[model samples]
Target: MSQGNYRVAIDIGTTKVCTIIVRKRADHRVEVCGISIVPCDGMSKGMVAESASVTVAIKESVEAAAADAGVEVNAVYTGLTGSHIESKNRWANVPRSEGMRPVTDLDLSAAKKAAGAIDLPDDRRLLHVIPRSYALDGLHGVRNPLGMHTGELHIESHVITGSISKITKLHNAVFDAGVRVSSMVVEPLASADAVLTADEREEGAVLVDVGGGTSDIAVYHDGSVVHTAVIPVGGFQFSNDLSIAFAIDFESAERLKIKHGTAAPELAGMKEEITLHPTTMSQPLTISKREIGQVLKERTSELFRMIQLKLEEPHLADIPTDRIVFTGGGAKLDGFLNIAKYIFQRKVRLASPRGLDGMPEGTNDPAYSAAVGIALWGMRNLPAENHVDERKISHTSENSGTATLANKQTAGALSMIRGWLPKRDKETAGT
Candidate 1:
């Protein structure tokens, strides 16, 4: 594959760090060229707790993927998720100085900027400002406002923000690992891109990405993101619950959870018993299958209820959909969907990564969805390699000229945001 066409994405999760390299073919489809997943232990609940350990893990994951693909990757698109993530809908109006003139791209950009002019605290950083809908004069719900005649153009936008300190730590970790961060995309958005269908997004759907340390949520309606959040509960909590209940080491508990865990205890065999010789235990231990299921059920139920509570927030109560899609490693637990359907009383399904070609067979699971989608996000948001002037970067000093190129790259990224869903042509709005 040509170097100019290679795109890399890294997903730094609590339990693992995943890196994927893809090459865009002549047909404009991305195909996996190399992929690597390495166990990580430097993060908790989506925030880096030990920068050194995270850097090491990122380095190992990236180098392995680069070696597998026989290419050098200098930069990557990484996923971000944590409880610090926040979002809200903001509206703005732009009155055309030239009254009744046809709406143009410049007018759209101005409206987006006006909507995104929020006063954020010093600790917070803006992530994305996505336009949900538009209005011309007093008329609302205009999908494409361009070319319309209006005295005032109004836009309702979804603005997403995150903690600057947390983002800086992650950025430093990736930099120490020897790759520049091309851009940072929220995890829920990336996972939704990998699994959600166009119809699901347009018709309204809730995407729950249950990772190792967090379950990220993204709600979509009319083909735009309306809400996003990160819950600090996931596979790690499930295994920890088992560990504490059984008085076993975390590794043993994790093994047991993966081998016998289920959200619905009633689905497990009533009399089946499992035996374990944990390193923490001197003698063999035997436990009932249903007992393990019962423990997990409590945590699983709590997580679902939390998700429900989040949806019950006053702004979300009237959302027009009852469909929820679950993705990521935790969602693969036996009986996960069965329990979710029972709790939410809505349509539910487990989804895996899509839209990429030549994915390795074992990588098609929900666990790899964020990583795959990060690659797709890079394809959509990052500037084309051919468009960047390599000579300017090579000749630029570390502090001055390099800064100019970085600014240009950042502008390119923001401009490429068009829309979060696949294939929309509107410009993004955010810092």
Candidate 2:
């Protein structure tokens, strides 16, 4: 909880908004110090439907974490994902001037910028431009072309784009909550950072993060990202399916999904039953666990089938699916691994954050994986913006008041946020 050694990140999900505060240890490693979750309003499928309501929810989540960490939070790093998110691979080759023999940061920057010149609608904006690899002077797949003598340079990049309106709504909500976003990470990349192992990323891996409203797909091979996608279906759909099938309310369906649903109904005991309290005009209904599993199985299977079709896209070119990791709220379903194994037909592992400290026991669930990933990503990349105490800010703005919206002019602000702060060896530092 020491002020100088802390960083915080927030995940604005459809089901809830979660804030996590992490503290760097004496050894320079990080540990969880504070964690907060609040019900989200005015958000659906990762878009802000109402800035006013979302702003209040953002404040509630941040303040809860601040209170737990005993330090105020003034800025946070957040991530975005929705069906509107799309991706493509781009290549840019630029010729250098006569005197400009060696590649420079400016050249690299220009090359990256060139890759985004592809046509797009005015309502859309670039979300991220990740360099898959660089080539200098005819050498291919160069990790860094810095200071290399070359008449030309080329870059293979992964470009992600989304609706400008959706991003601006998110920005306004956080801003009106009185915090500036240091940066924005795409949800799949953030989760991959937190859950995917170096070996997996290097040898070819895929991360499927099925949250309340969207399922994000990211594929990596040769130590770089190759494909990314957002599927419109996710855990929320399963809950809705159960709601209609059992004649129960949405909240009750969600609870039923969490408590008894399974992806493989054939494995469930047929006689085990769950009681559903009836509404005003009906008698209580008793549904068998086998039936619950059957309903969930049909829906979850369809979702995975949809994911399969996405992976089979021609542009993906069959990147290594040798390893697949599952995270997020839906991954908790019983018999999930079996279903995923059958659908993905690969080695599948259920994953969450691995090396965190100070978190409450059993609080480490698939649902919170992306939130933890956001904190890890921010602490590694973004500078810690100085914290301002709650006392100095006005309670008037904190109230349910209307906010004037503001938007930053450039799209590259997010593209430039990827840099790891150097860390000294923890054990050797204090010695």
Top-scoring candidate (TM-score):
1
What would the per-residue lDDT of candidate 1 be over residues 25-44, giving only the tens digit for each residue?
A: 76788777667777778887
Q: Tens digit of lDDT per residue, candidate 2, span 309-390? A: 8888787665767788999977888998998898777999999776566555444678778888887777776666544454
Superposed by TM-score, candidate 1 places the C-alpha of residue 374 at a distance from the truth, in angstroms, of 1.2
Q: Which ten residues in a row have the lowest lDDT in candidate 2?
A: 401-410
Query: What lDDT, from 0 to 1, does candidate 2 have?
Result: 0.74
Residue 269, candidate 2: C-alpha displacement in angstroms? 0.6
Candidate 2: clashing residue pairs, number: 1
- Stretches of model 2 off by over 4 angstroms after superposition: 1-5, 99-102, 116-119, 383-431
Q: Give candidate 2's TM-score.
A: 0.84
